[model samples]
Target chain A: GESVGLHLPTLSVQEGDNSIINCAYSNSASDYFIWYKQESGKGPQFIIDIRSNMDKRQGQRVTVLLNKTVKHLSLQIAATQPGDSAVYFCAEGSTSNDYKLSFGAGTTVTVRA
Target chain B: IAGITQAPTSQILAAGRRMTLRCTQDMRHNAMYWYRQDLGLGLRLIHYSNTAGTTGKGEVPDGYSVSRANTDDFPLTLASAVPSQTSVYFCASSVAAGVGEQFFGPGTRLTVL
Candidate 1:
């Protein structure tokens, strides 16, 4: 399944439930992708990152899945907490290029207790 | 240490007024970027500097200009403010270019009247 911005786009999960946020990268040339979490009245923070060579990577309780064939990326948060509620942005980076990061519109996550 | 701090956290400016959003990074990163985030549209790159003393345009660079005079500062200036330029501006930097994660600042919210 592809995680375009508009397909099953918005996900709502109760507190403590696992949450999955998805994104689709358009450029096959992108070799690096990063997930950033932006909370209210704050800036985006690096959550986790994965290279195109790897399909899955984990950090703490967060996991990032990359599918190159379909050009998809997904972030899974285990035991999603209330503090996890924020907009998540996925940015794609190209190795051959300097420092151009193509960012998505961002997905707003709401956690309900 | 202040990871990254933006001046005038929020501003209200009149049309045709000139405003400069200051971004200072203490990380001593070689690369820095400026992006503007709109409501529906994703974060669009305005300008970027791979290293100090050089700059380049990004996806959207028409209304913005940037200067990387030194290693720690990258400021974005709007010659003449316009309503279309009203959006949240973010400053980000990465330890390395090509393939690496980026750390972002708190962001500046600008509203042009």
Candidate 2:
């Protein structure tokens, strides 16, 4: 069975702190992974992505790390701000050519000022 | 530019009724997808289109149908609405399939009684 799951349901962090969100996927064949951010009443926005060939990828204030051996993926947000409060989801892409994705349950991060 | 737009921000409908959710993208991407988001379950793909004339069923496609008559539009149709179908629907588009980033719409909240 293919399943993508998050380690935490919620995370509360103080402003300017660093936040790390963890995710795990059961599909070893999945070669591509992506992170998404969803705010209240809005659809998800793409944050970052990593391929099985790479161990890490960084974007603006976010970093995505992939550990293929354990099928684990993590998103690190630096200097977490109040505007960063949102639900984050990790998705794994299938081996097919269509880039079909399986999303994780999601972890809600609350950045308190 | 409006990357992606979904019609009817929110809707309340009775069970057993038919409903259609419209999705359009101004990016003129070759791939479009429909997904439903639910509490604790994450977002599940309902259907997808690789091009203007090709469509495929996704993980949770049993209760939904879709059509992609053109590159900009991919509409999802529910033959008979059920309470279980209540969820926020999102439409996404990517420049190409398999390895590109996806841009998501705001989402449409649907409720059934």
Candidate 3:
């Protein structure tokens, strides 16, 4: 079955440093990708998204990069902050599936003070 | 304004019992979705409704059922609770279900014993 997966399960970074999270997807037909952040004891929140036609999209301090040829996606945070500690998930969707996203296992990002 | 609200913030149910998790959105989005979040496996869609009175099964929908009585309310029902069904459930809604961002609820934590 086609799925979205993360390369790393956990990432620790110091405050004020840049952080990057990587994700790999198996579905070639997927055209839409999104990144979500989930804090402890809360539901996932949207961070940013990118379409297949575009290679990168930026939102605030976050940027989403999509590579269709490699079936890879990434989320980059400009500066790590204590509040940025949470689980980040990458999801993929396409028109063929009515845009129902397939989420990744998630990467836990911990920002250290 | 409340974007999305889920009832029974947490629940502990016994096996074979029937339970329904309520979800309501004030945004009046046309698309609603129900997803379960597990430890290692991120969020998996259980069921979704493109609009009122229409429903579709998602990645995992065996023990769960959903109904979109109207554009504002979409409830997920578990006919027979099992231990495997113990997980945090989140309800989300989007404007029309394309590449648009989906607003998520606070989530309902269900523990089946």
Candidate 4:
């Protein structure tokens, strides 16, 4: 079965630095991808999303890039802050499957002051 | 507007016991989802409802059930919990099936001992 997965399990970044998380998916039919941030003791929150039609999308201090050829997706956070420390997950979905999303294992990000 | 709300922040239950986790969203979204978060496993969908009366099984639906009695609520029930059922459960709602962003609830932490 096709799945979504992250390249790294953990990432430590200095405050004010840029952070990037990578994800790989196996389903070529997937057209919608989303990034979520999960803080301790809380549910995952929507960060940003990009569709297969576009290569990239930008949000508040965050950007999502999609590479359909490689089935790869990434989330970049600018000026990393301590508040940004959390577990990040990438999910993929397709309209064919009623938009049911398949989520990656997750990448835990830690910011140093 | 209190996007989503879940009951019982945490719980510890013995094996064979039954439990129901509550979830509600004021957004009146048309789609609701239940997912379980485990160490190294990220989030796995258990069940989903496209609308008030329609339901579907997801990746890990065994031992769990869900009901969408109305637009504002989607509750997940565990029939005879087991040790493997110990995990954090998150409830989410989207504007419509396969159409928009998903808003998640805080989550319910369940430990089946």
TM-score of each: 0.94, 0.97, 0.98, 0.97
Error of 1 at B62 (Å): 0.5
Clash pairs for candidate 1: none
Please give, for residues A1-113, the per-residue lDDT of candidate 3 as tens digits.
99999999999999999999999999999999999999999989999989899999999999899888899999999988999999999999998999999999999999999
The alpha-carbon deviation from the true structure for residue B21 of candidate 1, after best TM-score superposition, in angstroms, is: 0.8
lDDT of 2 by residue, A1-113 (tens): 68899999999999999999999999988999999999999999999999899999999999999999999999999999999999999999866646888999999999999
What are the per-residue Cα lDDT tens digits for candidate 2 across B1-98?
A: 57998988999999999999999899989999999999999999999998999999888999899999899999999899999999999999998777
Candidate 2, lDDT over the whole model: 0.93
What DockQ, on C-alphas, does every prediction get?
0.80, 0.86, 0.90, 0.87
What docking class should model 1 receive? medium
Please give, for residues A1-113, the per-residue lDDT of candidate 4 as tens digits: 89999999999999999999999999999999999999988889989889899999999999999999888999999999999999999999998998998999999999999
- lDDT tens per residue, model 1, B23-84: 99998898899989887666788999989999998888998999999999999999999999
Question: Candidate 1 — which residues are off by over 4 angstroms?
Answer: A1-8
Clashes of each: 0, 0, 0, 0
Q: Which of the numbered candidates is closest to the native, going by highest TM-score?
A: 3
Name the candidate, 2 or 3, with the larger lDDT value.
3
Which regions of candidate 4 fall more than 4 Å away from where they truly are?
Answer: none
Q: What is the C-alpha lDDT of each candidate?
A: 0.86, 0.93, 0.95, 0.94
Candidate 3 Cα misplacement greater than 4 A, ranges: none
